[model samples]
Target chain A: MPAELLDGTKTANEILGKIRSQVAVRVAGGGSKPTLATVLVGADPASITYTRMKRKRCESVGMRSLKVELPAETTTEQLLAEIEKLGNDPGVHGILLQHPCPPHIDERAAFEAIPTAKDVDGVTLGSFADMWFGLGGFDSCTPGGIMRLLRAYDLPLSGKRAVVIGRSAILGKPMAGLLLAADATVTICHSRTPDVAAAVREADVVVAAVGRAEFVKGDWIKPGAVVADAGYNAGNVGDVEHAAAAERAAWITPVPGGVGPMTIATLLEQTLVAAERDA
Target chain B: MPAELLDGTKTANEILGKIRSQVAVRVAGGGSKPTLATVLVGADPASITYTRMKRKRCESVGMRSLKVELPAETTTEQLLAEIEKLGNDPGVHGILLQHPCPPHIDERAAFEAIPTAKDVDGVTLGSFADMWFGLGGFDSCTPGGIMRLLRAYDLPLSGKRAVVIGRSAILGKPMAGLLLAADATVTICHSRTPDVAAAVREADVVVAAVGRAEFVKGDWIKPGAVVADAGYNAGNVGDVEHAAAAERAAWITPVPGGVGPMTIATLLEQTLVAAERDA
Candidate 1:
């Protein structure tokens, strides 16, 4: 029998519904609608689309969106100034900087400029530390979404051998920290990892975030493992060989309808949280 | 033959000598001596001793030390105020807040109050994120010391399997981050880990920081594995069973002179680096 599909779309919808009602209550109580300011540098087609989707989600949930689009050649100082503006805006409860902001921009500097209180997208170093130490702070969206999905599926994390494949700040690294916080024995693997398959074979939970399509073979998965594929490669391919993995794993997430949707949903949810705190 | 002892005192002395000469050069070049401000909220004997040792090391390296001793009943706000004073001082390049700052004190809050640039002990959230992301920041003292030991021993970290026992922010967690940054497939095990021995058995390197005497038995170590006991339990016992582990391991750290001296050495070394950057 195939693995039980952990439907991220359904889970995300449920989370959105809760956030929507929370926003409604706040508005009904004479509070202004929650606002998220998204800053996009350059005209990257994918980034533009992502920002649009996030804005649309905000509007759909009765939240406000503040869009700031900059030219491709925006300097790091200019970007930081824009982020600082949004951070200090009384109307803006949360800030999201659509990533891959041109190769020339000092991305980390820009991230650092976002105030920790307004960092709903959780890109700031403060947020990263909070996540790593299990302190109360917003998490990077994808990792936060992954954790929520695991909870929704009732997967036991404590004492489980979890292998996170990738070391990207937003995904693999934070995922490992989250798992470790949840009491799982966490191992982080990357391209430099000598034997990714060997590591995966020993994991009770395998999180594939390496951005390579079908990089983790189905046969490499431990039987009855919980597989979370956080990759979105070209042609809708995921990091895991899903069909093959489904044959061996007890639970798995589909490529398109899984981690992707949850990422956006988590962003929206955290925006509401920031709104509740700041608004 | 027993396992080769990874000598921490010798390595620490070597590092101190280099730092001493660097300090001398800076002083001769008309630069003011670097200063490390040590903040102690309580007069816990161990904390007092640790601070004294750090101050002595600072003096030995031609750096200055400013000690701030507070009452045991110091409030979190009071502690924060004291740290802020040190942080704003022009002569203070680094700040070290002795840990176990009274049960009533909010240690994390106080640690966070230190400026990132002056966080020579690497206790600030910013430093933690920087270290975890391999973005070139001061590491927590013990973990930084452990990494230096590994490098000094010429242990190949790339693609090696490293198991870190314990999850304290200052020790185990950062140790895992440093190892992962070095390209080791790093696993973090804690009290909640169901089969720590099993994890240790598969490791190419085992770092025991659980603060328990002889918690990691000799049989748990993989033959020829590098053992780093970061623990200093009562009676000067380390987390790993030294005698037993030595029988099977290729390298092991002694309890007293292993990680202890290196911790203070790294702390002093980082203070000089901070002074170089900020002074």
Candidate 2:
């Protein structure tokens, strides 16, 4: 039997649907609109596209979006100052610093400048720490989306063996943390892992977050496993070889719709949450 | 052949010897002796013994140890205020809030109260974030101690499969992060992990940190695996069944001398580092 699709597109829409209604309700009660301030550094085409999609999500949800575009030559200090200013802005409930800022900039320093309260994009170490320790802070968008997708389909995680491919701060690491918090025994594999296929075979739940297209071999996925492909490469492909994985997986998320839409949805949802908490 | 003992006691003594000489050198050069402020909330017998050992280490190393013993009924606000005062103290180089505060207190809030610069014990989320992201910050003492031990023995960690058998914030979680940072394929298994023995069998290295006596069975250890037993239970027992494991293992840390002494040594080491940085 073909695996059931996790359907991140429909799931994300449902979440945004609730967020949209809540935004209207809050505004009707004379509350301010939830706002997300996205700071785009440099001319990274992918970053530009991601930021645009996020802004569109904000508009569709009846929330406000603020775009702070900076040149490729922006200094780390300048980026930090801009983020701190957004943190102080009363209208900005959430702050998003598009990733892979110019190589010269101290990206970590810039991420740290976003105040914990306004860190809806979950790039700050404070957010990571909160998530890792279950201390209650906004989660990184893609991992947060994956968790929501897992829950929507009622997948059991407690006591399950989960394998997370990649260890990037925003994706693999946080995804592992969330799964650990959910009581799933998590194995983190990366470039240094000598036997990625063997590790994948043991996972009841597999998350492919490494950006390489078709990096996870289909034959490695265990039958009846749940697969969430968070990787969206240049060719609209994911990290996993989808066609083969889907045949073995009990549930599989499609490449374009699996992780992408949910990322923006989680960003918007967390933005509203930050605004409500502030209010 | 029985496994060679990792010999943490000897390792810790060597580290302390170096720290002792450095303290004398710094003081001779007109630098103030490094001071560690230990805020002991409630008189847990174990905590008292632990703090006393730490103070002894401080004295042996020509450092200052200030013990702030608070009442069992101390409010979280009071503890926070006291910690803040210590953070502001020029004499205090590092701060360690002894764990397991009385049930009434918000322990996380208290841990957060310690400034990042003085968080030598590494309880704060800031420290966790820094460690996870590979940015510079103090590591949790036990994990730091474990890392030092690994390096002392010249254990090769990169590209190895390691399983950590606990998820406590200070020990298992931080240890996993450190191993991940060192390029190890890491699996974190806890009480909720189904089939922990199976997980243990496949590891090139196993870290037992669940704080249960003999929780990790001997037969589960793979031949030639390096095992670090971090759990110290009552009756001088460790989390791993040592006798059986040693018979098949390549290297293992003993219960009484392993993980215990090195923890304090790492604390002393981080305190000195913090003082030097502050100076």
Candidate 3:
């Protein structure tokens, strides 16, 4: 039997709808508005589009969005200072730094400078620690989205063998941490891994976050594996080749319809979660 | 061939002897002495013993030791405030909050109150981040101890598969982070891991930090695997049943004679490193 698709677009919209209603309630009560502030460095067209999508989502949910744009040549110190300002701002409920900031900037340092409370994107060590430790506040949007999608499908994570490919701070590491917290025995594989396929094959749940297109082969999947491909590569390809993996995995998330829309949706949901705390 | 015993006690003393000379040099230069402040909540005999051992280690190496004892009934805020005081004190180069500080205390928040630079025990988020992100800084003592012992044996960590059992913040989690930072494909299998033996058998290196004695079976070891038993169970039994694992592993660390001494030695070594940085 072919694997069932873990349709993320539908799942994300359901979450957003709940967030939208909550925002309406707060607005009706005349409470302080929930706001998300995003800082974008330079004007990369892709980043611009991504930021616009996030802003539109925020507005749709009735949350306020603040946009900060820095010139391409901005100094690391200047970027950090601005982030610190937003971190200290009373009205900013959550802070998101649009990644791939110009090459010379200290991205990690900038990410760390954001206050843990305002770190709705869950990029900071504070967020990772809290999330991994299961003392929750905010989580990295993509991982949070993946968890939401998994739970929506009634997939039990407890005692499951989960393999997460890639260890990028924004995705893989946190994803493994989340899975581990969910009571799954998690293995994190990356470029240094000796055998990625063999590791994935052992997993009941496989999370593919490596950016390569169809990096995880179909045969590497267990017969009933729950496959989550977070990769949105060029030409709408995912980390797993859909056609082949579809026949193997018990449940699989598609490329364009799967993780991409969910990423933005999760970010919006977390922004509301962050705003709710402030309200 | 049977595995060679990686001698932690001998390696630890060798490093400690080096630190002693460095301390002598600093003292000769008329610098304010390197100091380690230890906070003990209540009197778990084990906690007291560990604190005394650390103080003794500090004194032996020409570093000053300041011990603060709090009553068992102390509030979380009270404990945090004391740590904060030590954090700001110029004389203190290191802060060690002995673990299992009264079950009622918020251990995580208490650890966070210590400034990142003075966290010689590497208990804070900064240390975890450093370990995870591959930036050089202090590490949790036992894990630091394990790393020192491994490097002393000329073991190569990069691109190796490392399986760490246990997931405590101070030990297993940080150990996996350290291994991952070294470019090892790291797996953290805890009580929740269903196939612990399978995970252990596949590792190029195995770290047993789960407290259970002889929990890691000998037959599960991959021949030629470098095994470090970080569990110092009662009656001197390491987490790995030493006699059996020693026969299978290519290189193994013994229980009492292995990781125990290395813990204090790594603490002292990192103290000197912090002292040197401060100097």
For each candidate in the order shown, give its overall lDDT on alpha carbons.
0.92, 0.94, 0.89
Quote the positional error of residue B228 for candidate 2 in Å. 0.6
Under CAPRI classification, how is model 2 graded? high
Error of 3 at A186 (Å): 0.7
In what order do the candidates fall by DockQ, top score first? 2, 1, 3
Alpha-carbon RMSD to native, per candidate:
1.2, 0.8, 1.3
Query: By lDDT, who's the top model here?
Result: 2
Question: What are the per-residue Cα lDDT tens digits for candidate 1 across A170-217?
Answer: 888888888999999999999888899988999999999988899999
- Real interface contacts reproduced by model 1, as a fraction: 0.91
Worst 10 residues of 2 chain B by lDDT: B127-136
- What are the per-residue Cα lDDT tens digits for candidate 2 across B93-171? 9999998899899999999999999999988888988888788899999988988999999999999999999999999
Please give the distance, in angstroms, between residue B32's alpha carbon in candidate 2 and its true position after superposition: 0.3
Supply the DockQ value of model 2: 0.95
Ranking by lDDT: 2, 1, 3
lDDT of 2: 0.94
Q: Which candidate number has the best DockQ?
A: 2
Q: Write the per-residue lDDT of candidate 1 for residues B75-94, one digit (tens) a residue.
A: 99998999999999989999
Candidate 2, position B231, lDDT = 89
